[model samples]
Target: MKQALQLLVLIFSLTVFGQNGNTDTAQVVIPGRYNSVEAQAKPYVIMISADGFRYDYAKKYHAENLLKYSNEGTQAKAMLPSYPSITFPNHWSLITGLYPAHHGLIDNYFYDYKRKEPYAKSNKKNAEDGTWYGGLPLWGLAEKQGMLSASVMWVGSASDAGGARPTYYYPYHEKFSPEEKVNKVIDWLRLPMDRRPHFISLYFPEADANGHHFGPDSKETEEAVHKIDQAVGQLVQKVKELGLKNVNFVFVSDHGMIKADNENPLEIPQLLLDKNRFDIYNSQTLLRVYVKNPDEVKKVYKELKANKTGGYKIYLDKKFPGSLHFSTKDDRYSRIGQILLFPEAPRIFLEKGEKSTAGKHGYSPKTVPEMKATFYAWGSAFKRNITINEFENVNVYPLVAHILGLKINGPVDGKLKVLKETLK
Candidate 1:
């Protein structure tokens, strides 16, 4: 048994060391879609989620290393985030392979009718409770199968998502800087082999926060982009210096940013739910107005649809289009508001006497191109210098599972086949 273990370790060393520094058609041995012992011990995958990073940001900012890596490895032209493309939802989608609706993180914040509670990013209690988030996340899955995993402030990392926390994790801390997070990941990487995580998840929020405070086109956003690029450069240099073999590195974003203006905000003469005797829980981009009297559902929907104008629309939850894949038939069909509204780029939804200015996401990736995220992966298992035009972001969960040779059993919407073409 010990000899077999030693052999596995040697295979891992060869897989990583054999392909070091060979930029020309270089490849490393990976477990080829097989969940064998060799596959389990072969590679280390590090996933970095750069908040609100648009697909074009790489080229727009001339981030040399990102551009060069994507050019040399596998990159998706655009990664289509799930509907209501907000932070928590899409971030969860990337790890769970389920749409926001199924994952139950429908928006950055939403109301849960059954529990008569509201789930918001600010609420630590709800955020840490795994019950609210249905599907399994990659880190939790790793722990379940006796593999070590680490997370650095990635959304839901604090949660007992699949009934366990990562072997190593730094809970979301607002004061944490990009440099600090990167340094910590490097620390985790340098741990002894038995203590080191096979999978690591990292998050950076400067660009996303700046993109919201200053529109995506502003100098502030540009500088923030550069800062993150430098941080990534540091990560690559350190990894290469450590001579970590067969390490798979993925740099991606939850969703993209769009320039938003409050100049001609969508006007709602009536706070429909309030006017109709109801409580309201609303996110900047989506609203879930709880009707005190269920019979008024139609009345509320009608009033909202009637008062809505440019930049936004109102619809009954029941009548929401199927293409959005937000149907509640699978779960929580009743939790969302009876009425729904979505805003277009350059449009902000404000109540009768509201005001704002900032960039935003949550818009459909289908129309507002800026809302589309980015995906890039390089190392042993992925194809080199390949570019796939576009792909659904949900498939990312499966892609990670495939790279790790994990056989996940829970139901997931993302199909492995969708991402197979991009892998070796």
Candidate 2:
């Protein structure tokens, strides 16, 4: 009976995998790389990102494992996601230590006036193309310094950002179960010291998917949180069994979630719909408007300001609030639109007849507490029983680099001073 039940479970898992279609399960290896003598002697870090894991999800859902682990190590009140807290931008920011505007992935979807093309997260070619990315990610930074790295699935890992990819990596996909992912990490760590990755990244999308489909407060979202927590426990236990004393874990999330006002969704102003005047990219909480003629900026800005509703605010690119670091001065790639629209929480801009999801994000974290992400570190590298105040996500890059002894090649927004106290 036990064997029969096991077979039934295997069949069910295969059926679910088939539904997701054929995904590349093979690991992509870049040969002829080894950790430097100094790096091999340094500690290992396995940074995991659980997409859309809200700041309070663990405690709210009573995720026993995460709560215990964080209590034993370091926990933050909250991690502030960069402005326009969407997945692609925030993930890249976390990895590269640059603000979204500075890193050039200003939004998940936006038109690049210079390239005369649109960058959509759903476009495989655009996502994998290294030229679209800026700044050296953690993996690339490690590899450049003669240390090996790997990634299960990270935002920019698939792309050859910073002129190199992780020595071992898998392109973004959802076919791998949490157990499979943890096992993959174990396998990487089990390899010979010369070939094993010193810096590794793991990603999970369950919580985000559930939050968007069933709302942040739904039982489905809670279950997803619990699953992630359990996976963390499993990974930690497996590492302990391997007797890897130097391995450290840093768990984080790109952003949080909030229930949107789906029933009374905000409508796009008619002026934005005029193709002759503007090209628009809409992400519900934030809207980017590109003006065709430079001279028409003031005219359209004036008109939109008069027609603005209560749920959203419109701003000219040059006049964007400096605190958000999304203004013209901060746009390193000139990717930000001429005009912007920011929707308040619980209100999203949706077109007529288009359905809205129960949960949404992408608001400035300063304005909406719900947009704050999570940060929990529990490993030999971190201090124990320490809880720090809120800090921006950019600071995380330096903290990881410090632990692994990888030097930042250039100036990044993240400063080690902000998070150095968390470490021993």
Best by lDDT: 2
Q: Give per-residue CA lDDT, model 2, range 181-264, as digits (tens).
A: 999999999999889899999998889888888899999999999999899999999999999778899999999999989878
- TM-scores of the candidates in the order shown: 0.87, 0.94
Those runs of model 1 whose alpha carbons end farther than 4 Å from true positions after fitting are: 1-40, 269-276, 306-308, 330-333
**Worst ten in a row by lDDT for model 2:** 8-17
Task: Write model 1 residue lDDT over 1-424, tens digit each, in one string.
Answer: 2122212211201011112243233111112122235434658899998888899998998888888888889999899998887888888999899988888888655667688666666555777788888789998787767667888878888788878678777655554567877788888778667666788899888778788878788888889888888888888888888888888888889899887776777654366534447655444565556677889888767766666666676666666767677754634535566666776676766655444547877777888899999999988888999999788888988888888877888889999999888777
In model 2, what is the error at residue 121, expressed in angstroms?
1.0
Local distance difference test, each candidate = 0.74, 0.87
Backbone collision tally, model 2: 0
Residue runs of model 2 more than 4 Å from their true location after superposition: 1-20
